[model samples]
Target: MTASTSHRETTTADGRLSRYPVFLRVWASQSAGAVADQLLPVAFALYAVQRGAGAGTIAVILAGRAIALVVCLLAGGILADRVSRPRILFTADVLRAATVLGALLTLNRLPLAALGIVTALSGAAEAMSRPAMRSLIPALLPTGLLERGNALVAAVQRSATLIGALVGAAIVAAIGIRAAMGLASLLFATGAVAVLGVRDSVAGARTRTGVLADAAAGVKAIRRRPWVVAVMTAVAIQLFAGTAPTMTLLPLVATEQLGGELGYGLVLAALATGALPAIALASRWRPRRPGVVGMLALSSYAALPASLALALPLPVTAICFVIGGFAVELYFVYWLSALQRQIPAEVLGKTLALDQLSAFALLPLGYALAGPAIAAFGVQPTLLAAAGLTAAASVAALLVPGVATFSDPVGTKSDPAGG
Candidate 1:
């Protein structure tokens, strides 16, 4: 399915995004911080290799981070809804900066176990901030401008990460890996300072609801829109099928069947390049039934792994990946906008947190299964299975009551809390 055949006004009368100096300040701050965040894997990998640690050690460090992120996400959301989101963001970044500094100072001297713990701490700090970041925008702008706000945010995040990866490479090349980490910390500190401009009011006033009750309400709110569950289920299953297999098997396939590291890099670059247009597309595109359009767009992602299983030529596979990339962004941006528009502002933070946890909590299982599956069935079969699982999950979303039928200007759907 294609995007809707029309455009929406992307900004409002009192202010465009650029007119909001505080938003601009937060944007620049978060952009620089995001770049530093992109440097983390490189810094960790380089340090481990230099210190005679193996891939297994690096994996353990990464696993620590991922585990912490999943565990902390719900709590972060609860806190964001209950208190000040900007302060939470500021605190999270500050904590991340400190953790990076500690890791930098003790890199060579720190024990492997200690390093893993520190990495997990950094991840936890990041988890604490994300729900606040995601939910803050509804308070910053009227509902009408959400798509545009998301578009600008997406642009900044993607562009910063791309630039940050390159800059990280340069930093690692010129100085030591430790220096790159120091730079990451400095960038995070800058982000923390930038968020200071956002007053406590950027998040709506804290409701009188109790924390646990509010969290329950978030879940109840999600339940009211059965399609939300369908969307989350589809996305989670897709991630479970896509992430581990792609990370583990795709590199091997590139080496065995395609051009090796160069081919692998090219395919990844294709995905990134294709996704860049989504920012512009999402800003103005207004579909009559965004939920249905989003599901169909997401289903296109299954084609990528299917192509890999076919042992297609590098060019063919890259083309498939590009299609998947483009479709995936359309799905993400539209789904996010839909959630913001449909879900209540008071519960948005908790709902976002719950959404994140559901999507990521199963990733470890995917990793654990990928290698064994490859061992038993071989690369072609493993990739085919991933594709099949992704396809099944996405198609399953269509069976849910409202996913295929929900229309735009989803009026009553917006206030399911009955507030």
Candidate 2:
């Protein structure tokens, strides 16, 4: 852990989070913001389909959003270090709300180009906000509580996404997409209100360093810590091989076998259902070698694709997703907590942006490939190939000395090399 992080380990009188009321307030804001973040994707997909836009059109819109997010993350990262994180986040939230509100104005008559633009702009705003929000946590909490803090934040976000999906779906079905968009805008506004009242530590973190110099420091931090880069590379490969493939293949398989869109959604929800509980469970569990353990945990993702390739029953595939989702959440909580503790607060935002860049830059390619592979080689072979690739990636992660030996500060040597 960084020297500053060691000095700033804030805790409650009896482990009650109420000890840090400001952090809890930020978490509340984040949870509310997540509702807006989650609503747009599902809304866009639904509205596009409702308007007779085909898969290709929907793909373009989603792709536009992802690309924008990836493209803006670095800038966001830099700003978080040089500006007040809460201000950055609040501004982004307001901007995003404005974009969604504009979309709501022409909901039924929304043009594909306009939809793509709005979604991309919204993604860009989120890209700026994400690292700011993550970086803010370390400033608010201590090294010891990073895991629990991250877990609570993650759980709230997952819950928001879950609830937002259901509520957005119901609104779209019962009322209209306009109502869903209105709800998202309202959520974003609520977050702005919450964030405005937050007493921030990040204001003191802003520096007079040039943007390029600040960004370079963040890069050097990752370069100095070889383990961070190694872990990020492995995660990138894992996303390309495992997460993206399952996301693409599941819907196709569900449509063919289970029922249709409803089946596909249920399978997706099963993963979230698994993940929600895992986040809560992880709050109390701190693994010895968190970075290493997270990498190994990712291997669980191989199950879903392997199950699909075997032409398993729909229930079995959903069960596999459930298992995979738990692993995914566990890995996320550990990996993020490790980063938050290990990295210095000064460069944390930029480092996280690099992490986000690594994680996002390749997944679109996986999604792009999955469709053609399913069309040509068929769903079974495509899923089987994805499973193999995910397994290979996991094994490759173990070969990285840094990933293999990395350990937590509280500290047990789970691996022989560390001992």
Candidate 3:
């Protein structure tokens, strides 16, 4: 069958994928890849602890990974725009597998510095794969299916994260850290195989240009599009403010108010669980003003830190997390859909990379401030400050004239100005 015919047959009459075989393959790859990605931090943390490394050493290793990610992600995006995404993904997976194998074999034998370098290299490979995989999605399915497709992928990622952590913990507890690394390698290899199964027909046409030029063109595109810039800026602010509380202080709140590590896991899982239903229902209901809906969804962030500080019952806290997850997922569907509609297929990868960079640029700063802020002001006050910042961000986005009212449905052509 022709590519279009096969895709049509797999989807419903509305161009929604009722049973997209290719999507299943793609999802499988993503799940395996996600498992491997999630395994890394857990494994690395355990390995560091076992090595008698201090918290400072662990921080340095993790920081190295983040720095490598920022450096490699843009190059990965440029490569994806200029070459086959599947090929890039496959290569990244192979590299990751090699890195993990090397880590497993040498972690016990090598110096701490050498192990840190290998871990950073693995993180770079994984970072390279992400933008390419994200850019590949618009080509795999029709425009009408993008929201559902994204939702499915997000759900798989969430599930894989939860499962991978448990599996990694079990492997470490049972076999050893080396065994956990071996499992990660196997997962990456499986993901590579799945990427090989994805047909080349879904790959976007390549742009003819050097890397710098291609990246520049992507920047120019964003510069010309006011709404894209605005949305990206808003997302960046939201992410920065939310990161401190979500990643750092939430654990403290759990430990101090709820219980401890167990409570932290429960809350995290609750957030993921909340997102599940949102993903399931995303495509079924189309928002008339997607941008506005997305902005409104940011309000949910206000609930999380405040609720935690109040020492709400465990059930109530979990429910709040569920609500927060649902809101975040809903907003994400709209945000990604907007990008798919606004950005051209040829440069989508670069644009997406830039978007990611913008959104996460402040994460390091947030992480840095979290500990000191909690130590100085205490968890409750710090959390309340985060909530206030998050709320202000939402309000700011809502007040932006075009952001709160823009909408572009699937298959509908959007005005370049994003009206």
Best-fitting candidate, scored by TM-score: 2
| lDDT for each residue of candidate 1 in 93-192, tens digit (9 for 90 to 100) | 9999999898888777787646668768888987898888878776666667778887777777766655565566556656777778888999899889
lDDT of the candidates, in the order given: 0.72, 0.74, 0.70
Report lDDT (Cα) of residue 65, candidate 2: 68
Against the true structure, whose lDDT is highest? 2
Name model 3 segments beyond 4 Å from true.
Answer: 1-20, 42-65, 109-119, 169-179, 202-204, 250-261, 307-314, 405-419
| lDDT of model 2 at position 150 | 89
lDDT of 2 by residue, 233-296 (tens): 7777777766666655554466568675456556666676778878987788776666566777
List clashing residue pairs in candidate 1: none
Q: 1-419, model 3: which lDDT tens digit per residue?
A: 23433353355336556556776676777688788777666556555655766434554555556566667778887877777777888899899898888778777677664655776788788678878878777777777788888888888876766666556656665677788888889998889888785764645545387777887877876765656677778777766676545554554455567764446556666777777787777766677677777777767767787787677988899888888878888788777766765566666788888887777666656656666776788767877887788768776775555565443233444333211
**TM-score of every candidate relative to the true structure:** 0.84, 0.89, 0.83
Q: Residue pairs in steric clash, candidate 3?
A: none
lDDT of 2 at 338: 70
Candidate order (lDDT): 2, 1, 3
